[model samples]
Target: MGRGRQKAKATKQARDIKYYSPNTDYSALQRELKGPEGRATSHFANDPVEPDYSAYVDKYADDLQEDDGEVDTRRIG
Candidate 1:
């Protein structure tokens, strides 16, 4: 309600946060980080699939080759 009360509440919250230390499950953390199979290979198991852009090159060959005279060679302010 008052400025002093609000300030005191904020200070108390800040102090609590500063000194806060909850129990950490290191085994669970290891499991999550290492991720199954007793190894970390689960993340690297699959290779990322790349999309083919070669089709677009053939379709827009003429458009890609044609350059408009509106090419700006000067530095833009």
Candidate 2:
């Protein structure tokens, strides 16, 4: 109900949290970290399939090129 009581409770909680050490399961962790036993071939095992971008190539192609079909790579302030 008072500041002193609240401070004491908060300090006790902080000490308890600071000293707490949770037990870890190393064998289960090793299996999970090791990944699948067999791999067909993939850089990313869980990568989502990508959609085809060929349909938009014609629409946005002009944005990437200048009037003479060259990218204006010169820096401008």
Candidate 3:
């Protein structure tokens, strides 16, 4: 097909898909959203997410670190 015909066909197909609506089962959706009755709402209570990093932060604060602040870069050899 020519470029114009191919483009028109693609445009029509895209418009059909954009306006398409399929039958929705809302009750099934509600059940899926509710989930199982016995399942925990969150797994955080049983697991240690992040370990104590404050100690490491304080300990490493003494180490010599590079300057993160802005510096004048205008000087050129």
Candidate 4:
């Protein structure tokens, strides 16, 4: 057998790319209701709680509100 340059075989070609329409309806989602100062007032206004950090917040209120002024501080530890 003699060594020869093998021609590359052409594979299946892909058709036109399909794309989804951009989400333009911002009001479609249940947005967070803002208070008079434009801040979230209700607890449910924020993202849904998975493990529920409220209990942890209550458990460590003293540590959480330790002059830092930040509401969420469970990650400090």
Candidate 5:
């Protein structure tokens, strides 16, 4: 088909889909929304526990403090 005909066909299909509303099955929707049975709600239920990094942060707190609060960005090779 020509470009104009193809574009017209696409526009008609888009309009039809935009105004179309099929019959909804509420029970099926509810079941689908509620998700599968006997499954844990948390997806991260099997994730490994993370170790606390507060100790490292506390150790480097004084070393990380700025003296003049200004960054020197001049290139140093």
Candidate 6:
């Protein structure tokens, strides 16, 4: 190959790429859920068909309790 073409082939072979998994913190989510602005944000973020948990107490009464604020790792992938 010519000089310019040879360099292009060598550069392509020398290149390396790697991908990493993203890290997500669930604790921050709990803080957001308890925060004032979070309540309003949650309302706008949720589906209209779904009941709002922040305003309605009985909506998620079966799924949550006052003392049950712990994160469930079992549900995570």
Rank order by lDDT, top first? Answer: 5, 2, 1, 3, 6, 4
| Candidate 1 colliding pairs | none
Query: Compared with the true structure, what per-residue lDDT tens digits does model 3 show for residues 1-77?
Result: 47999899999999999999999999999999888889867555776677877868877875526556667689799
lDDT of 6: 0.66
Better of 3 and 4 by lDDT: 3
Clashing pairs in 6: none
- Candidate 2, residues 1-77: lDDT per residue as tens digits? 57999999999999999999999999999999887889657687587888999999899898667467666799999
TM-score of each: 0.47, 0.51, 0.48, 0.25, 0.39, 0.20
- Candidates in order have lDDT scores of 0.83, 0.87, 0.82, 0.51, 0.88, 0.66
Choose the strongest candidate by lDDT.
5
Better of 1 and 4 by TM-score: 1
- After superposing candidate 1, which stretches have Cα over 4 Å from the reference? 38-77
Off by over 4 Å in 3: 40-77
Least lDDT summed over 10 consecutive residues: which range in candidate 6? 38-47
The residue-level lDDT of candidate 1 at 33 comes to: 74
Q: Per-residue alpha-carbon lDDT of model 5 for 23-65, expressed as tens digits?
A: 9999999999888999867677578989998889988888778
Model 3 whole-model lDDT (C-alpha atoms): 0.82
Tens digit per residue, CA lDDT, model 4, 1-77? 33332322211122222344566756644352333455546556466657757768778888757767656647764
In the predicted model 5, the residue pairs found to clash are none
Candidate 4 residue 48 C-alpha distance from true site, Å: 6.5
Candidate 4 deviant stretches above 4 angstroms: 5-49, 68-77
